[model samples]
Target: MLYLFQQILNGLHMSALYALLAFGYALTNGVVRRTNLAYGALFAFSGQTMILVAVFGWHVLWLTLPATVALGILAAFAYAALVGAILARSVFARLAIRTPNAIVVATHGVALMLMEIGRIASETRDFWLPPLLAWPVVFASQGDFRATLTVMQLINVGAILLVLISATIALERSRFGQRWRAVCDDPKAAAMCGVDVPAVFRHAVLAGGLAAALAGILTALHFGNVSFGTGLVFGLKILFVTAVGGYDSPPRAAAGAAIFGMAETLWSGYFPIEWRDAAVFLGLVALLVLRPGHEETRVAQP
Candidate 1:
């Protein structure tokens, strides 16, 4: 019973990370009608940037937790925005002259380039953040039954979920969301109706950037280690989440993420931990076999 409860707590924490990042990818895919593979790169970049900031803070500035964390968040956000702008201008905007497949391949190339850049920046060294909390905090207890999680983990999970939910509500109920929906339905028609099609695309990327930034920072803070390779693993996992959930619905995508996260946590807990990635891969294959189709057709029309 205790073990079962522990697994549930673990699953929720992992699910929060997956759901937030998947939400960002779903937003971009819904708008452009194409999977932005470079998003994975953006995720890695933000986390790596945070680690770099931490290293500098520790070695040079002698800053404490509050200062270092703030600096990391700021740097991650800035870097994500810059990367999003570049992707919008260089890859997405230019798709007018090429086939959609071209952009798909281009996005993969962009992801590789970003990973290479991260490798170079870090000089092939593993980067880490100072531990956010020294010990786990128990949330529930009853003589011999207890549930515990790190304070940092709890904070990161709660804060990211809150932000994602708030953003979703605002997007669904506000004027900006109305315009975004207009653009997504038919960019040409939206433009004809006085909607700024290109601007909406840019905003979508920027919003995705912010989501990626928050996910990156929170994940790194929770784990205390932000390896350059994490982005690839996370990227693949989220791709599966987006594919399974359907890009048109952020809420559904988040739901898919939770399922994946729980499955993974349970598998790792009961079996060989090293085989968890393979399990995820197998799960993705099975999901695709059961429901295979083009992602663009699934976007919700408003």
Candidate 2:
């Protein structure tokens, strides 16, 4: 029972990390039809950037979290603008003539370029990230029933929950959220109704990027390690969460993340950690088979 409880707590922490990544990816997919594979690069960039900042001095470590998030938002905005502009000038301008496959290939090429850039940026740096907090919270009636959580883990979980709740409420009740919904429903029609489709896309990308950045930083903080390849693992996990939960709803994605997190943690604790990914993959397959077309409709906007 104690072991089970510990596993649950660990799962909660993992779920929070997955939720952050899934939310960002879902938002981008919901708003724009394009999948920004370059997003994984942004996650790597945030971790590497935080580590670099910390190396300068321990005093600067305090700023790593916020600075990483800011950089993520800025990078996302810049990347979105550049990608959107390029597509507008090149591929999108030829939409009438270009095949869907061609556009996908082009975007994939862009993703590869960004990935290579991230790899180059952190090639020489150490992959370890210093711990953001020293103490862990302990709760136990007896030594055998003990459960421990680090300060950073608690902060990460809190941050993710806060973002998820705030985003859902804002999307359903806020004015900007209404415009976001309008653009998501139909960009051309929204434009006809005077919605700024381009601006909305930029905002979505920026928000998503910031969320991804925060997730990456928090993960590194919790685990005390990060590397260029870290983004690949995280991005794939996020994709799984999004697919399993139905990419159209933020809450659903978060729920899916929580489920996956619990499954992975428990499986890792009882079995081999190597089996964790396989367990998640199997769960995803089972969910898909069981919930056919569950995500057919987008969540209604407030």
- Specify the highest-lDDT model's number: 1
Tens-digit lDDT string for candidate 1 (1-302): 77778888989899888889888887777677776778877888888888888778767898987787788778888888888887777777777335655667888898888888889988999877767775888877879878898888889888978987897897899877887777767777777888887788878877887788788888778877677777888888898888888777777888898889888998877899998899788988788779957544422121
What is the C-alpha lDDT profile of model 2 across 1-302, one tens digit per residue?
A: 77788888888898788877877878766764545555665676565555545543334445565565455345444544555455444543343134433544565565566566656765755656545674878855466567888787888899889989999899899987888878667667777888777667667766777777777677667776567666766776777678788766767787888788877888988998887888778778787788756543322111
Candidate 1 wrongly placed segments (more than 4 Å):
141-145, 292-302
Q: Estimate the TM-score for candidate 1.
A: 0.92
Clashes of 1: 0
Task: Report clash pairs, candidate 2.
Answer: none
What is the lDDT of every predicted structure here?
0.80, 0.67
Deviation in Å, model 2, residue 19 alpha carbon: 0.6
Worst 10 residues of 1 by lDDT: 293-302
Give residue 72's lDDT in candidate 1 (0 to 100): 76
The worst-scoring run of ten residues by lDDT in candidate 2 lies at: 293-302
